[model samples]
Target: MKPTIIPFLTTRKLNPENQETPIHFLPQTITLKEYFFIRNHFEYPTQTQEAYFLPIVGEVIRPIIFKLEDIMRMPSKHLMLPLECSGNNRAFFHPKVYGEQWEDGAISQGLWKGVPLKDLLALIGLKRTALEVVFEAYDYGKRMDLEGDFHFARSLPIQKALHPDTLIAYELNGKPIPFKHGYPLRLIVPQWYAMASIKWVKRIVVIDHLFKGPFQEIDYNYYPYKDSDKGKTPVAQINVSSIIQQPQSYSILDNGKHVVEGIAWTGTGVIIEVEVSTDGGESWHKAILGQEQSHLYSWTFWKYDWKVSSKGEYLIMSRARDSFGNIQPFKAKWNRKGYGYNAVYTVKVKVE
Candidate 1:
């Protein structure tokens, strides 16, 4: 069956299927599956739930193959998580990074139901020498840079893999995960960017050494020296960031009271504050954080009431600060691959 596309999402690519969410109009706490942003590196893999089986092997005393029925009968866990594309807001990067030019909507939060990966590891009896856990997906395609077709795979540190929150998810928002997202099973790695959450998971390999796949060593690594490959670091945690959902750029409004609201999230810790700027960063005020309950890995809502009396163009900006005191920077550090662009979000609006 052909996947249904929402009219509001901004289309970036067709074959691999990348779309940005229309976050401006979405005011709900949890993003619906249809409205969530879609990011894919290769063509979607076709898998039948009845025929699917996930094998866990390597660096384990008791490797096991689990079918969909076995997974469903195991213990279940639920978590509210926000997943953001590593390249979200890549278009805004200075020097024009070459990749998907996503804006602010490449993120969405959902309640995921699954079995804890730690439980799976416990059942498999992870060996003491295990260093990393690699997840291989069924999706495979040829890349222009690589000669042969490669399966979409990524690895997480053994500690992260054993974390209680890491899950092998099968359901999204109380429904079976859509094929476009990840049907039968997908890994949900909290705190880290979504790339670590490999979809269409076919195999899990616990390695005694680091697993350096193309997605790990080549693409997601942040090259600070732009032209050179020195001092490059792996992109892991999501940087503290905020997006101005309402009063979009180039919006014209009458001079009066307006409620400017948005969302802020961080991978390191909970977002404690979000500040707003109306005079192009000249002055700042804290936005009132919504009283709604938010989980550790979910985005927090924030709003500010602005009463404008003068008529002119106003540059509205929002900066978020996390519990760890990591605040959004004026301009995100430039990188070659354009991953993790978390600069303070700015939107320009006119007041009549």
Candidate 2:
């Protein structure tokens, strides 16, 4: 159960066509407390501290039930990484898709402090055969299915679980997490988008087979294969993506020299080339890539300097080609529910 005194957090809603979508940044520039973007799956129930239980069971030598306070009593580590929703840029797709139409701001980088999962697993004892780690959230009272009420949970592969980067975060930015963004505790998965990071986290289950809970089965997970493709399989990993930060969508710019900047990251490999095109997709110019970052899963800043001549409305687009030649297309791999959108980012602007 969630603790009492859950505070109300503020967030800005986005209008798809006008802006680039709010990236859910934890606005550090202003405000007494950091902001949080709540992903409301169901109604919020009054959560108490006692009912907030974390069951560490399945494929374990000894099962242990952990309390929210117990985990907090342990050591805490702090680190920063960028996290974005997998369906963040989905609304930009011409036909439009389901899920929240997020702006680039939905992606934010922040510092988090929490006890490492590996440490907790050691205290509880781990079985050698354990291959996956499952996290269950408290807000499972209401759901998107007809099976009545069930708990909301998600799982991570054992390999990624033990990795140093994965965190059981309690604090966002410099303060404690607000109720809206999974107060008490939440899972943070770097490199991958927000979906990998489970909110309102409560339980951890170690298992051998893939843990197919409601969120896993009915939502979040997607098939890279199109509807027309037969015998297609649903994959769980996130795809590569990049987005322009400044001059979102269409900003009026006077015909002059300007520098364009953005951030890019890949789930599989490194981003080798980020090309920018001012005139549709005909010609391309290479952007100077920044230095390699330390955290393999975090995004890196990229920029390109360009000069504009004459006056009229112009459309600018950016396409990222990773080291593997996986180029960002104008249209993403479409789906009934938008999951991975690696389409070429196009922004229209008037040049006076």
Candidate 3:
């Protein structure tokens, strides 16, 4: 039985399996310890910068290797970005699929500092016709259901891999990353979900076409919109999502005023608004949006107040509309693989 960290486990490997578990927290002002749910394809190997070696390999003119000191000596770039699981909140829909059983705990934000992927590629002298670059890591070994070693790994398309925002992150939240969080070297594909940000990286290979390992071809890749044309629907990017965070449920009200607040974000743009419903979804009211953040990918906060009339059980829900005018779905579409579930967030409380 695989052990899990706290608040990170949505369901067990047993019947209650849910892989789309959401990471519940605002992207700004993060404490390293509280970053919601960590998904590692492999165990965190122990190796300091001096001991480990990072090599660029395959179809390249000059294969380069960097020691820890070499990487730290370079000019580092920092980016504060938010990432969400494509399958976040998928269990809310029908045909429950396999994944972390995430309730939107599949996200987090942090100050990521590292050399950009493109810069590193250029430093190594990438070939002109390199169609795609594959990141081969130290952690990939075997498959449990399969016979061989269960190695953990994933890959990205050359275009996405070389984006300026992509980072070979060495530090998270201004501190050296913790072991559970990819420690020595990891890829941070800003704005993409955590799955794409691999840990314990060791090798990078340049190939003529997209890499098709079990991860890129089988895992992480899911068919969206159930029973649809799997061919037509490529592995879609992170869909927009929002969640409420304030007014901890089950508090006393004694016929007084109250304030409600929450956070929201989109994979594509900033959150435009957060709507609140107090009458069990009978009606909706606009909540006062909180401090606007300049980081377009970071989550935004919102708030609303309830003038308590009577005390009883209250069912509350929050909906988010993104800058692109894509509103949160009341309930998300279901898939057997459980990908791209971005539904409205709901909560309940008892008032005195």
Candidate 4:
């Protein structure tokens, strides 16, 4: 087993590997490459930088192919982005959902270095008819839910594809992304769920209509109703959520003043505030939001100095509110696939 594989909580060990980060003790800033969470839908494909190339075809003025060395020589940009799997907290659903069954640790953040996708799109020049940009990955396999083998492909709106922040990342934390992650080239879609950031990208196709790949239409979509198909929407943005990292659930602590620390993040807006509740949602107190540790597309660090004078069992909870007036709900919207479970995070601890 690889050294990187030892630390994560393994969800799937076979054809397509999936691992969750140990978020309980993660660093306050960037999540190291070794400790980053891994979410894969298909088995690894053999790749060599020398033999790699990206072909931009469909709905373009002229089809072009970009070699690895040539693309690497172009001007690059760096960004710190947080990627949370659509199924990050699937295991927490009331009625167990059928999926990876991931816990809170399925999200991770990294400083990505790459070329902004808009630059490359400008080189090829998009046609006015282009509506969606489809990203094709190298990995392919048959899934139990699907009938035949299918490559893990997804599409983004033309506007989002041409966004200045979207990147075709080649490096993570100043080093080449590991094989477990997208090594040669990976799409880093900011603020969106990690599903939009397709890994192992080899082909880019722009179409005039919606691209109905299984990963997009069937898998990563949101089904609001219990059984009916009402209000089915695509899973895109990350929900407003916060995680408690310092004093873990069911931990025994000294009857004294303790610091409660955690992280909160959102997709479309900045995290304006985070409320920490020690009495199990009875009342909430504002935490000190770490502005220095925040970025446009990264999670924000929050801390609260909680004093415990009497010794007893205590329940702690944290919820976040975004700049767009989106607050964390008391209960998350239930879905069949269990995509975005962003309810208030609560933990029970014993004070001795």
Clashing pairs in 1: none
Selected candidate, larger lDDT, 3 vs 4: 4
| Candidate that would win on lDDT | 1
Per residue, candidate 2 scores C-alpha lDDT tens digits across 15-83 of 211122233222232222233344555555457774457778998988988787887888888766655
TM-score of each: 0.96, 0.81, 0.83, 0.95
lDDT of 1 by residue, 38-105 (tens): 99988888766633688999999999998887888898999998899999999999998998899888
**For candidate 3, which ten residues in a row score worst on lDDT?**
12-21
Answer with 2 or 4, whichever has the higher lDDT.
4
Each prediction's whole-model lDDT (CA): 0.90, 0.69, 0.68, 0.88
What's every prediction's RMSD, in angstroms? 3.1, 6.4, 5.1, 2.9
Where does candidate 4 clash, by residue pair? none
In each prediction, how many residue pairs overlap at the backbone (N, C-alpha, C within less than 3 A)? 0, 10, 28, 0
Per-residue CA lDDT of candidate 3, range 1-352, in tens? 9896454444424421223233443334453445445555454455666335788877677788877667888888887776566656655657677655566566666778888888778877777778877776666555655677745556666788788888888988888876666668878886666667877777778888766777666666556655664743334356667676655555544556776666777766667888899877789999787766676666777778888778787777888887778888887765566777777777777677
lDDT tens digits, residue span 1-352, model 4: 6565334555544546888888988755898877788888877877766336899999999888988777799899899978999899899988878878798989999999889888898999999999999999988899777799998899999999999999999999889887778878899999899999988997999999999988888888889767887788999989989999989988999998999999999997789899999999999999999876446878999999999899899989999999889888888899988988999998899998
The reply for model 1, stretches above 4 Å from the true place, is 1-7, 49-51, 292-294
Q: Looking at model 2, which ten-residue stretch has the lowest summed lDDT?
A: 12-21
Evaluated at residue 67, the lDDT of candidate 2 is: 80
